[model samples]
Target: MTRRPTQLLLATLVLTVTVGGCSNQNHTEAPPPSGSPPAPPTTQGQFTLPPVSPITPTSANAAPTGIPPAVAPPQVDAAPFNDPLRVTTAWMRQFCQTDFMEPINENLSRAATYATPAATAADITRGDTTQSYQQMQQQKLATRCDQVEASINPEAPATPSMVYVQVSAARTQLADGRPFQRLPLASTRRVVRGGDGRWLVDSAVDAG
Candidate 1:
């Protein structure tokens, strides 16, 4: 009867150990399967931006490389008519020629280039007397036989821009090479600086 009681107690102990082992296996975590992908990580409140390219700086007035600069045109020199005495002498030689062979209007036109508008008008009016005198000489001689010789004398002026000139002219017979007129004609001329910075004959008046 004592052996039966000990065997019953041992049976109860084995049943309790088996039940505890099954409960522990139910609560424990299971391992992942072989070759399966891992779970993704959490990324709350975080972001990544794409990369940006760098910019090159340039100037507004800078010329581009590998091109040549433009070349400037060559400049021309202007005619010089700066002197007072030189222009005055040139004017007299051009205007006072007593050539009946050359056209008088052509001579006057060339002379007007060296004078102002007022001076040019005055010179044209004076040319009428010269034309009449030349006609009279041509009728009397019946050939081109007379020429006028001129003498120029300049007086000191009040200003650098103005000059007073005295002209003495004589009519000579080209055939005999002697004075044809008894008295030499006298005249006064005024030369002044023009607006364009060149010297010009401004006026001429017969002297008494």
Candidate 2:
């Protein structure tokens, strides 16, 4: 009977031990497989944590290694007209005088020749009168420049240098067979660098 009771107690203890071992086995879990990515740990009521990123540095502004800032050139003012080409208002004022008229008319003739054929023809037809266009030019100048006054525009642009001359004169007329007093005349002339780069009278016109 003592042997039987001791054997029973041993058997009971062994059964209990076996049951406890099985319970612990069911509760434990195996680690993820090698080469498999690991799952994130869970927080309260959540399955996984959000992803985290690695930090990178940034600069406000960056310039290239060898570049430099741009700078502008300085500007200078131009020189006086009379000082450049030795031209004065008096010189240009004589374009209409008889002795000076031919050279100026020659320039005009050249200008007209280069014009359209119709214009050149018209100039020829009108040039036939006794008061030839050249003579008329002289007469008109005598009448207008009888009382000549000149004003100098000191500053003008020229590559080899030039001068601008202006003349204000008067026009006279006869009314009722009596000569009338003079009326104000206005004209402008440009002295420019010609083909030779010498300052020469290039153009003249009635400013008004």
Candidate 3:
């Protein structure tokens, strides 16, 4: 009877030890195999993005490399008769005619627009003397004369404010319908800027 009880107690102890060994083996984890790929990392709260390259700022008017920039066009003056050559040429064309039939006062007033006060006075004095001689010749010939054609050639010299004009004039006799005379004249004219920003003839000298 004593041997039977001892055998039963030994069997219970062996079963308890075997069950504990099995429980410990099941709870433990085995190591991964050699050369195996690692598992992907798990995200916890928020995802982190990869870094990006920075961009550089550029000017609004900047031109690209190896390219030329755009340029504006040049401005041009639009004033009328603003140059010495133009004003001198205009004066010679108007007063170089042989037909002095217009009134002396009207002619002098018109000439003053192109010439200075002193120059206009001097020119009128010379014109009155010449007209008296021409009138006497017309009366002696018993014929009236009128200007038929005129030509003007202007030359600009090294001086910027001066110009020389050459005039070729022809007159015809009204009675006989024949050519009356030819008057070739050369004059030096100086121009100046007026108060109103216009070019005006300041003085003139008849060279012929």
Candidate 4:
């Protein structure tokens, strides 16, 4: 009888040990397989960095990193222009200027801001057909300048609201990093004080 009771107790203890080992095995965590990529970080809010290379602005897209900021053009609407000649002269400087040797679409677009709405459309049309200021090769122009002398003509007196100015710009172009010369341009430009109380170039007939 004693042997029988001892055998029963030993069997019960072995069964309990086996069940406990299985329970522990089920609760333990397992690590991921080797060579697999780590899981992405989990965060409450999302964020991303700019894609490499594209955010860096090129010479053709942005102003030259070395040059100073350009001086603001004269205010065209600060009451009636006291000296129309002086005003138009300043306008020419801004209108005929380009920064970083940007091509016509990039550089001259600023001047178009001073153009009348109709004139702006006409300029785009002309640029597409008759004249092209874009360089054949992409390069920063050393400088582009126009020395303009303008005067309001008194001979054509048909329309009082309209004013005619004879503009002569003696230019030196360093186009596409090539040797260049002084090219003179003459134009009979029609300027009008638009309804916005600003002077705008309405029409221009170039005498090249």
For candidate 2, lDDT tens digit of each residue in 75-163? 12122222322332333233222222344344224433122334334434543354554544433332223444555456644344444
> How do these models rank on lDDT, best leading?
4, 1, 3, 2
Indicate the worst ten consecutive residues by lDDT in candidate 3. Answer: 66-75
> Per-residue CA lDDT of candidate 1, range 165-193, in tens?
56443322221222222223345677787
Q: Evaluate residue 128 in candidate 1 and report its C-alpha lDDT on the 0 to 100 scale.
A: 43
Instruction: Kindly list the per-residue Cα lDDT of model 4 for residues 95-145, writing each as its tens digit.
Output: 544544445544335555555677656655654221334332233343344
- TM-score per prediction, in order, is 0.43, 0.30, 0.41, 0.50
Candidate scoring better on lDDT of 1 and 2: 1
Pick by lDDT: 1 or 4, better one: 4
How many residue pairs clash in each candidate at the backbone level? 0, 1, 0, 0
- Against the unseen true structure, what C-alpha lDDT does each candidate score? 0.49, 0.40, 0.46, 0.53
**Distance from true location, Cα of 91 in model 4, Å:** 3.6
The C-alpha stretches of model 4 lying farther than 4 A from their native spots are 1-84, 98-103, 128-134, 139-143, 158-160, 176-179
Candidate 3: give its CA RMSD in angstroms: 38.2
Any runs in candidate 1 off by more than 4 Å, and if so which? 1-80, 129-157, 168-185
Q: On a 0 to 100 scale, what is the lDDT of residue 123 in model 1?
A: 74
**Which ten-residue region of model 1 has the weakest summed lDDT?**
66-75
Model 3 clashing-pair count: 0
Question: Which candidate would rank higher by lDDT, 3 or 4?
Answer: 4
Indicate whether candidate 2 or candidate 4 has the larger lDDT.
4
Candidate 3's error at 91, in angstroms?
Answer: 0.8
Q: What is the Cα-based lDDT of residue 50 in candidate 2?
A: 24
